[model samples]
Target: MSVRTQESALRIALVFPGQGAQHPRMAAGLYGHEAVFTAAMDEALELLGADGERIRSAWLARTTTADFDDVTVSQPLLYAVDHALGRMVLDWGVEPVALMGHSVGELVAATLAGVVGFADGIRLMRARIRQFAQTPAGGMLAVAAGLGEVEDLLTGQVHLAAVNARRQLLLAGEREPLDRAAQALRERGIVCRDARARQAFHSPVVDEAVEASMPDWLATPLNRPRRTVYSAYTQGVLTDDTALDHRFWARQAAETVHFAPTLDRLLADHDCLLVEAGPGNSLSTVARRHPAVVRGGSEVAPLLPDGAQDDVRDRRSVAAAKERILPLQQPVRA
Candidate 1:
């Protein structure tokens, strides 16, 4: 019996962030360099029956605030940025062996996997964002420097959102519950930091959103992915025949993400290069700091908000990141 060997290939994992990562300037730089990226942005505007330029400008406003806080804006913006960056990577001849998205980012990953089309994805995202945005007055916060200290402090009122590492944890719920949890953590000498989003994602508060958004979710066609896509909900990779159904993804907005465990399996399977394909270095920051990860992607620019400077895109950062990935891109040990 000849057993197949899954060689440690130079595998790429194109990752995107959840709604919390949305920014006003998302996907600004890829306008010219990546065609699909630009097309996705245009499609988003057109699908919503809005003027493309005006919509883009309103999102790119001078205020240092995010337009994505508006579900109408965030749903499309995140999809556009992630798809655009993935398109650019494809153009560069780099195909990811796997894909993953954090919370809402999973929708983008679904699109990349061909689990959904760009237009249908935009429509569904719009509905989903609206539901989540309307999730009553509640939100999420991050507690830094140890889950053990914070876990004991969390009462049943609030739920743990994500455990990024041993020391980093995210808690989400109504503001009051989060406040209580944060206060308790502080008493235990834990440093708590909050993410800059207006709503609590991946927690039970958005159950209403999930229920109401189901119609639109099912209306969208599910397609087969071009590759394997890992689920934040299931804490593992989704195979060709199965993935989180529409309802599962919708419910995800109201559940906690099992990020650390999902990542543990991803890194164990391949020679991973985790690229922050969308806005901000939030996910990249976690990956580099996580004990499970070692070498990762070189670029660290948010995919949107045109013209945000990237240290990685600079001549020097490119060289440094490339140096780390060079061996994997080639076959021989140099």
Candidate 2:
């Protein structure tokens, strides 16, 4: 495709993630290219009084998926990488018409959208990590040939976390009941597996944690966003500072994410270019499942000029896209 055509077709939507996407080396390439991103990461480490280098190296390390499963470490690191990448993309001048963050990734999305300052977002992440850390939680996995059937299977012990599609669902709660539910699904020939996550994030268990952290989160200042930021909690476009309330943040931790609802609402009016702004490719994978959306860039070195390539980790074919990164600008609007 020609550059002009590609650019014209770009109606970007910046999508942020919650958890389950992190690695030590996720954003190493952008360290030099996007210093502000690096600075944001450094600030995150400073908040914890830990070595940033060690943290980066830990994520970059090639290890089993289990190695990166700790909620405390994963949450902050995910934010760092996503925030860094989001800044790099904005610097590249690829403005999105809309922004949506999944779970914790919402903070990164809000930061990039100008809804919240970077530093404050990082601070909130730190507090959020601590607040939600104490609660005991676990995640569920199921591949449903039929999603409707599984709805009846959810018990009080387990709750739906994410709806990846009409056919895929994520359940969260205590471990034993979740395992039993998985076994039941398996009996039905549904593909169900346990997620690597230790915490049942986005469930009722985290309500107290979120509530304790709310006064502090709300105290964090709000800034005007560059683009419209939609909230999964509200399932609508966020237009005011009041959007960042206790109920919103609390529900983010305690409620199941109706991603389909949020995505459906956003895609209806906009020709969206969905950019998964984070370390791992989970959000991007989810976006690809939707026929209406397309990917922006990935993590490999020297992909897009102004460091856009490092801003996102494109799980697409790297072998075919080794061309030197190109400098880009906003295409003229129709």
Candidate 3:
């Protein structure tokens, strides 16, 4: 469809979850049951090559991984699952007003937006996982406080990784420093949760590590997105410069995600349904806190149940999510 026609379509915004949102058996139920989802997931994993095989085996076997958060496992898996879920939504005949994602989730959205091809994204992520794997052991923690409340707690190693919501923040750093910071928060009566991650993503410690990506980025094909995209990295609508900027993708792992502001920009433009197409309700939870949603001017739909829920069937959740978005599209378009 033409850009003008696409712009005139219904306003449905998809928000993708980043790292730490993963868990065992996420979307496993859809592997054989749902055609679109199954095909998309299979295609992505196949493109992932060897690592894809490993992930697929473990997922189907339902093996409990000791370090499920490690980038090698988490990144590729999330990319595949998120991408598949996004494709499933599109299959429902919904056209999003824009696409937005948090952290690595941005890459998933970019892939769907045609900013990067599926095979190329697989290449970039595989290369990224290898590079990130070499970094020193580190961790990420979600703290329930604004930067003002936690700025003094940050060290050279432990820095702000993400601003997820008004008071929801994430910190990343080498193991000890991040743990120490988390301890401090706990002592101060602030709640903090560990991310299922081993690499201190978005930390400067990885800045040099990402430098090696210059060649990879240059070698990879880059293109402007055919669809409107919002970037948490840029805290605004994605521009051609940002989309095609090799440096941005290269440095993404070490840069803080400004998800709150990015979502604000999207909602400011259109009162759309927010569908989180990922493993968990992390993005959905954050979206609920927005005033537009709370006042019923906007809505939030989750494509999957929380990773914490062992009984929630992913396929059923997809059906439920479909019902939520499809019914609302006509009203929003009106």
Candidate 4:
């Protein structure tokens, strides 16, 4: 299952989603069906204690009132589910050649890549959730504009949180300013949608949180990734000179996620399958729509779809991965 083994026919790329993709009962299908997934979830729950129990209960209940959107719960839960799904994919015989994660999802990639151990990664995620929970209530808005247009809309109140695509931008800040910006954009006939986030993430609004969490992040040990890991912060492949220290994560918390550029890099350089190992196919859809992906001819697939039957989704994922790894046929003529 070592990603570096180099025996697999397909060059697989594992991609994870960040926050906002979480739902009330994500990964319910895989929980008991996949042993590796179950083991990973159990380990994470044991580490998380009561908080983990709450999340697990919500995820398992046939019906219940659970707030999956709370930052404190969502971040760690997403990490655990994503990590378990990646492990399940490995168990299915597809080894990743590289890994990429958007926003908080990077922690999962880091842990799987050996950049950080599972226990330590969970601790960091918990510390991060605590730090962010202290921030004043805020929200995020997605506007249909390019970077320059979005930047012009910033009035010392809001900051660009993510550049998802060529013209897709996310802004985060205090609720009032964000609402005002959204109204203004709509008045101009632009499409804007509320992201429904409880706090402003990946913006200057979280600067204080970033500063407060520095000591914990710095104290955590990290190592070079065993597999290639692209950084959404840098929008490029992580290098030896790139520091995975506290300063790096501090900046990550307060800076825009350059996801489009990072995807472009992966598409341009790697003949790999883009496998979204998360609850939804949103990132997979984004990757499929990218020009580089269309031009370069890389396959994009999701491990699961929203609200799909458990057995169907699992079967589809296995079929897709197996098809991708099949060797090219030899010339028929003798």
How large is the C-alpha RMSD of every model relative to the true structure? 5.2, 5.0, 4.1, 4.9
| Tens-digit per-residue lDDT, 44-90, candidate 3 | 78888888888776556565576577888888888888898899888
List runs of model 2 lying over 4 Å from the truth: 1-8, 50-54, 64-67, 241-244, 293-328
lDDT by residue (1-334, candidate 1, tens digit) is 2322335345667888876676655555445544766676666777755434555775666444444465556656677667766766665566676788887788788887888887887777666555666776667787786666666555666777877666677888788878787787778777776675567666777677878888887787776777788877788888655553676756776777877778777877655678777776677877776554543422232333323444324333333444544444544231
Candidate 1 worst ten-residue window by lDDT: 297-306
The local lDDT score (0 to 100) that residue 138 gets in candidate 4 is 87
Candidate 4 lDDT by residue in tens digits, 225-309? 7878898988888865563565886667778888888988987777667888887776887888887567655778687775453
Cα deviation at 88, candidate 4, in Å, is 1.4
Models ranked on lDDT = 3, 4, 1, 2
lDDT of 2 at 81: 74
Alpha-carbon deviation at 272 in model 1, angstroms: 1.5
Please give the lDDT score for candidate 1: 0.66
Query: Candidate 3, which segments miss by more than 4 Å at Cα?
Result: 1-10, 308-312, 331-334
Report the C-alpha lDDT of model 2 over 1-334, residue by residue, as the tens digit.
Answer: 3354644454656677667655456666655555666777777777655434555556656553453666666777878877776765666566667778777787777777767776776677667667876886566464554558777767678787877566767788777777888888889888877665777887776668878887876687666666788877677787675454545654677777777778768877676656666655566666666656533322222222221234244323221222222232346465
Residue 266 CA displacement from its true place in model 1, Å: 0.7
**lDDT, candidate 4, at 267:** 78
Best by TM-score: 3
Give the Cα error of residue 317 in candidate 2, in Å: 8.4
In TM-score terms, candidate 1 sits at 0.83
Q: What is the overall TM-score of model 2 with all chains considered together?
A: 0.82
What global local distance difference test value does model 3 have? 0.84
